[model samples]
Target chain A: MTDSGFKKLVLSHFWVAFGAFGVASVLGLYQVVERSGLIPALQSPKVYFASVSTHGVLMAYVLTTFFVMGFGYLVAVSSLKTPLWNPKLAWVGFGVSAFGTALAAIPLLTGRGSVLYTFYPPLQASALLYIGAALLVIGSWFWCVIMLVMYGQWKKGHPGETVPLPMFANTANAILWLWTSAGVALEVVFQLIPWSLGLMDTVDVGLARTLFAWTLHPIVYFWLIPAYIALYSFVPQAAGGKLFSHELGRVAFIMLLILSLPIGFHHLYMDPQQGKGFKLAHGVGTFLVALPTLITGFTISASLEKAGRQAGGTGLFGWIGTLPWRDPMVLAAILAFGMLIAGGFGGIVNASYAMNAMIHNTAWVPGHFHLIFAGTTVILYMAIAYYVWPSLTGRTLVSRTLPVIQLWTWFIGMTILTTPWHILGLLGQPRRISSVVYNSVLTLAWTPYELAMIVGGAILLGSALLFLYILWKSQTAGAPEANAEIRYAGYEEPETPVPVLLNDFKLWNRIILALMLVNFGYPIAQFFFTKTFGSIGWGY
Target chain B: MSNLIPVHPLEKRWIYVVLGVIALFLGAIFYTALVHQVHPPGAIETIDSATLHLGGEFAEDKLGVRTDADGHLRATLVAARYGFYPREIRVPEGLPITFRIASADVLHGMHVPMTNLDTMVVPGYVSTVTTTFPKPGEYPMLCNEYCGMGHDHMWSKVIVVSRESWKAAAPQTGR
Candidate 1:
């Protein structure tokens, strides 16, 4: 585990992941408090949107991307049992992404480009913001190249052998990201860049929206892949069960990689720019993508159940309680997975085509995503941090009890905050309103939810503080414990080869090529075919 | 020996049955929903004879509203620029009526939980919103979307009329 070959690269990624996460958490607390509207002095819609936008981009895009990249490095090195094909290039990618983060933060913090986190067109950010975001993606592109090279290099070195499972999942994620980023990259480079630079007099909103649609939804899988890898490779074994069908795990990853894109039209469902036909096409694709999630849910949930049963729980569902809740990783996954079920259920309702009208542009939308991203995904990221910190830094985790409490309080707070958000959406509360100042019936309905959200925000802020404290203290105060080795659960790799479709990327690549052609071909064609109507030139 | 060992429970006989059932159910539902969505619009226009016919009730079962021949919405409003249609368009217990609705002017979004009807009415365009009334008590026909200068007063009422009174105030009554 010395810093020579594989561990060196893995450690580099882990450092970046934790470093970004710690900073993001500090910003997250500020965001929640300011957004609460309780602090009148803090209430500036302009500042609030900028903060909200940056906070979202950091946690969702920046933090998640870096952490996932780091985790992928670990999987590649250990599981593939190979040195990273180009460590120097991997470092180059890291530098690019970090530089991009710094550049993007300038406009975000200064209110120079407060287009909110989602860089939808008509409202443009500074050219630096677009360039910075592009560089970040470009850096990730380098990671993608390295990943593919490593996979190919491994296969070449060991002819006729199956790829390692974690590497397979890791590479699947890399491919997913490459495909996922293309949509927005096109939008950013072509539409946003020109608009921001004032090179283009008028930008096509529909075209811009259509191109972003390509990246909008699939990018979520980029965030979720590491979590999925953990679910497949780490969670089952940690729960004292065998990998519950390795093939199922591979199938899920492949399904996810292929299915996530092409259907991003689900986001454009309400927008008039994309036609009903394309919407339907993407809608069906949306449902198809759900299959992988269901597989993950069933496989992971069943694995946990089996783990619980083995630990001496009784009854069909009774095994839930027998599992250890004390371990930070275990406790975190349990809480995180619980959020996934609820969040995933809300997603089902959202993707219901017609039912979407119920929640579109409502507070429910953010509520649902926060539950998924912050509640489920970030908590697991925390778990990964907690687990890796001791091993990586050679220091004991300070206040293990605090990490557990932080995870729980975070979970409880997210649920309390988000449930009311859903109800409020139904109660006709718009998503991006600055404040509620009415005393009448509809406004009165919002009061209880707003009050509950304040409580939730406070709890979450406390949890964030505790998390940073533990990580900081571990860095400084914790006793040294050298010979700190990284560990994985005892689970035998399944001997059965997954069908070639799952293991083989070749077929999926071709399939994706065809699907994208059909899904996007005409929809994008229409932008060129028909004359567009525009009012405001691109606003920078 | 290159003969590969199958993964744990390689031939999972039990999984086949369960997954098979799930696949079947999923396939059926997927097809039905797809068909329902893709089907050509069934334009069933109602004949409204009354000057003001009660349209979609605010309920939990259906969506949108149904109207009669006279073209006036057979509906209720808590207040309109402010007005609620006469309260007698009632259905029997558990029976849900279709609310076919359209606005004569600006955009107004409507929702009633008892009938589960929610949709918007746009001017000129015959906007059809529907719902079924399940509960008996008067429910507020909330203007979920803001409309006018008088938006605060834009509410309507729903009087879930029983079958007996419904017949008494039937179109033949002309009252």
Candidate 2:
């Protein structure tokens, strides 16, 4: 592919993603106001649930999936220094996923699929929602196939050579997605679709929840891997420092891939349908996942430390100031991790089987997710967008200042919104209620917190609009003469022969499988020996 | 600040001060988490003995209030999906009583608001919560958890009347 040719493909995926993002943001703002219960006129439970379901699907599935797929394609093409193996197939994936999105929207927007966004049993939405979601996953699987093929092709072309860091990281993520999605994919295909369609006599709710949990935890990794890649490979370079360690990067990615899969049980902590042995197994596995996060925290911090030192920072943590905060990529990385600490810590608590009781099904659930996904992951995606816009369009950025403003606002809004949400959860505020109208002391306690959330929501709404304006202006305005593709830290990968095991995944996959066998082998099996759980029919 | 090793060109001392400020901020959150106590919601007082008796709505309708300081008595009435029966509860101020509590129809949390105390009250289970009415005002008990329609309307006023009157009424009400 020509230089601009690859960019156009990437940009197309981005355009689709941003289109979805822009739409989702508007829906999101409505949801915030709609759920707040301050305006009685806007507080129809039907409309509120519909808006929430659509908003979640649009943001969590649509925006993340498309952006990650697009990022994967571009990163593979550019970083691998190779052509996209099947461009037509990639577009086909896009077409199918987009079509699936439209189909899903028909049901979600009509207040039909208001069973909430989760795959809980007895609470059923329309059959179309389940089917459309399945199609979307299938479409994503098509992208997964293309990613793996591109990866294998690259390996074949350059035997014994290390894959470019970006491609390697991207491939690891693709592999993780395949392994992780199997559980949910099976659930959707076998359990949900059939039940929703009325073909199945009854569905086992416990089994469905357990399987979805398998997909749920690892899926966070799928959304997050791109952000991590941007952190490991792009941020240091953007900050004008060489990557601190290629070897450590490999370990972190591999650890993430393996750790992400086995720890799927954390989501089942509060679920009664799953047994204690299984929950304990998953809970222990949850702590194992924390290792990779710690590794990541140290590695990324050290990398930033390096970047700071290179920019002439001295003393421990003093160099943190020397690092460029103005560069959108660098700023995004910085902000991303700052949110990660708050979000990640909440995740650890959620994973702690003992503490799960504290926040189960509470507002704390959304609070943690919003901080992680919206605060950290989405910002980096936006950072990538900001960086890529000029290169793809042959124009300079419309306003460098606006990107930073948007990032800062998103961070601030999330902190304002979610901190209180966590507190509200602790205060016995159940999620999904429009109002705590009972006027008891407990409900009385929630009023101040709810008021704070409204302010946070307003700030975030304005910030999202500012983001659209920046992206839109970049597309149409800016100096048409400024399009220079940048390279990694201006340093060629040091010419060296690395061991095959260190450099590639020949043995890693086997190691992962074996570890997974040891890890999840019995936990999954215990489901059968235990008393057969009674089936709960589809609920609406 | 003393370990601020000189390293790079254009490195400013002012930057170090800013970093120090941030370090201090993060340090404080750690300090708070380490030193602070996290009080989760739960049953603060437990009644293992048969001192406090909890029964269902049928039992509650025939319930009598024990006396307290100032001769006042009180009780908490819970609201559920079905129409409220035994909606009024009698409680004695300063007098501990076993509240035999049960919902007439769906499950509910038999919550005492001020004490941050509650227990799940299932219909057949006859879940009871017991506490002394330390002070007397018209303490309104409401169904906070969702049961169904009339959830909002499910509430009863606890009148902590004088012990003399409660004694006179208790015999008549029990009879």
Candidate 3:
């Protein structure tokens, strides 16, 4: 394929992804300020919920899906040294998803689907929104197939050689997504769509929630694996060091793929429908998922430490100071690591079945998730964009200094914003409140934190605008020569041949299938077998 | 092959250390849950959500604080769109009270923020949490779940009072 052809494929998807992010950022600012009720003019529950729902769907589903798809293409082409298999089908997927996004946006923007992103049923939205969401999932399925086909083709050609780590993980994510989305896909098609279109009088809320739980938690890893891919395969090289261990990276991905699927029931711990035994089983699996994250943290940190040492740093901890702080990717990895530590702690707390009651459904949950999803994952996405954009667009960035500025403001702003959010959750403030305008003493205690959040929101908004501006300038710039080459971090290959299980996924896929049946089979089957009640749709 | 680098022994040691720390953390959480009696929210019983208001323990007239078969003080509450059934709940202070909560509609979560009392009130199943409020006070119980358009206004309070005051007021039955 021509360079221009590949660039077009990558850039088209990225534009949609970033476009959604740009809109969501503005809506997020609106929510923080409106929730504060600091400005009476902005205080409206109807609008707040609408904006929140749109913001969530855009950020969680639209942005992550498109970005992952686009980035997966770049990884496939670069790592596999192959042209995109079935490019026409890839375009078809993009078109379908984009159309779906547009269809979903209509009801969301018009306040006709203020059900928030969870869309927990009995609270219904317009049929268009449900159909749009289903279409988006279907479109992503096309990307998954294309990815797997390319992966299989590369493996066929390479034979005994190990697949490139980036492509390996990318393909793993594609597989994970295909499995992860099946639960929600089943729910939307069989349960939500029919109920929303008014063809069904009543919908089973327990079954709907049970199915959603199957998808909910693993989908996070789908969004995250790209960020992790960048960390393992890109950041070490960007930081002027080798990957600490390539073997560890493969292990982490494999563990994540296997463990991420069965563990989603932890999200339903607070819910009534699932039994204690099932929740406990899922909780155990949830704790296991944290293992891979911890390993990633250690491996990446060790890689950076090696980089710092290579730069002539001495002493046990002095290596940290010697590493590159100016490189946007390196800086993002460092900052993202800091946020991940805090986020990981919060996750451990959330996964602890008993302690979850203290923070579940509170503002603390959002605080914890934002730190993970927005803080750690999204920052890495920015870093990946920064690294890849120049190569993809064939132009030098307009301003080098602006990216450093953007990363800092985002980190600082998130800290300022989420710190008070965690506190408010502890102080008895609920998560989805439209306003904290209550004049009571309990509500008044949240005033200072509310004010702090507004300031943080403003800073974050400015940072987001700066990010968009930087991307725009880079894309539009005219450079002397195109810089289309990508440099991934290198690590020492094992002197002995790497194990087949680490290299190929056939056995692992079989294992995952069995595990899924064992872990999820009974829980999902019981829903259909049991005497369950279906509730009628109420909300619009 | 040219770019490949070998893993250092020290890095391997660090990996072990990291894994050890993770193991310790998980072990601690399990210990607290199993040995320390820190239990999560859920009951063994299942109820038909559509007929919640019709019959059995969660029926409309049978909601709120009552004595269970085991002679334990049990409180039953229904979570639905816009409000919690028996919106006002009164429980005696300084007693181990088991709250049996369920949702009549979609997924709703009950969180009284100041206390270790938050659980999802989903349909078709009952979530139970046993706890004691040592201090006598009015704890505002907020529906933290995003139920619907009226979610913001879905606020209720649980009045925790002394046993003497509780007897004087009497446990009001039925919604």
DockQ of each: 0.06, 0.06, 0.52
C-alpha TM-scores of all predictions? 0.79, 0.77, 0.95
Task: After superposing candidate 1 on the true structure, give the runs of residues whose Cα lies further than 4 Å from its correct spot.
Answer: A4-37, A314-318, A437-440, A489-499, A538-540, B1-175
B168 in model 2: Cα distance from truth in Å?
18
How high is the CA lDDT of each candidate model? 0.67, 0.67, 0.85
Q: Compare the candidates by TM-score and give the number of the best one.
A: 3
How accurate locally is residue A282 in candidate 1, as Cα lDDT from 0 to 100? 75
User: In model 2, what lDDT does residue A520 have?
Assistant: 66
- Model 3 has a DockQ score of 0.52
Write the residue-wise lDDT of candidate 3 on B15-112 in tens digits.
Answer: 67876876786788778877887777666557777787788878788887886667678888888776777777888888888888877777678888
In candidate 3, stretches whose alpha carbon ends up further than 4 angstroms from where it belongs are A437-440, A493-496, B1-12, B54-56, B68-70, B163-175
Q: Pick the candidate with the highest DockQ.
A: 3
Tens digit of lDDT per residue, candidate 3, span A1-540?
246877898899998999999999999898888888778987788898999999999999999999999999999988887788888899999999999999999999999888888887888999889999999999999999999999999888878888888988999999999999999999999999999888998887878888998899999999999999999988999889898788778888999999999988888888776777778778888887887888788889888988899998899889988989999999999999999999888888788877888888888888889999999999999999998887888887777799999999999999998989888888888888887633335777888998898888888889988998999888997363464577678884443556777788889889889988977898888867877777888763
Residue-wise C-alpha lDDT for candidate 2, range A398-502, written one tens digit per residue: 887889999899889888988988888777665555455554565677778888888787788788888888988877878885545645432223645545654
Question: What level of docking quality does candidate 2 show?
Answer: incorrect
What TM-score does chain A of each model score against the native chain A? 0.94, 0.94, 0.98
Candidate 3 chain A minimal-lDDT segment of 10 residues: A435-444
Model 3: lDDT of residue A152: 90
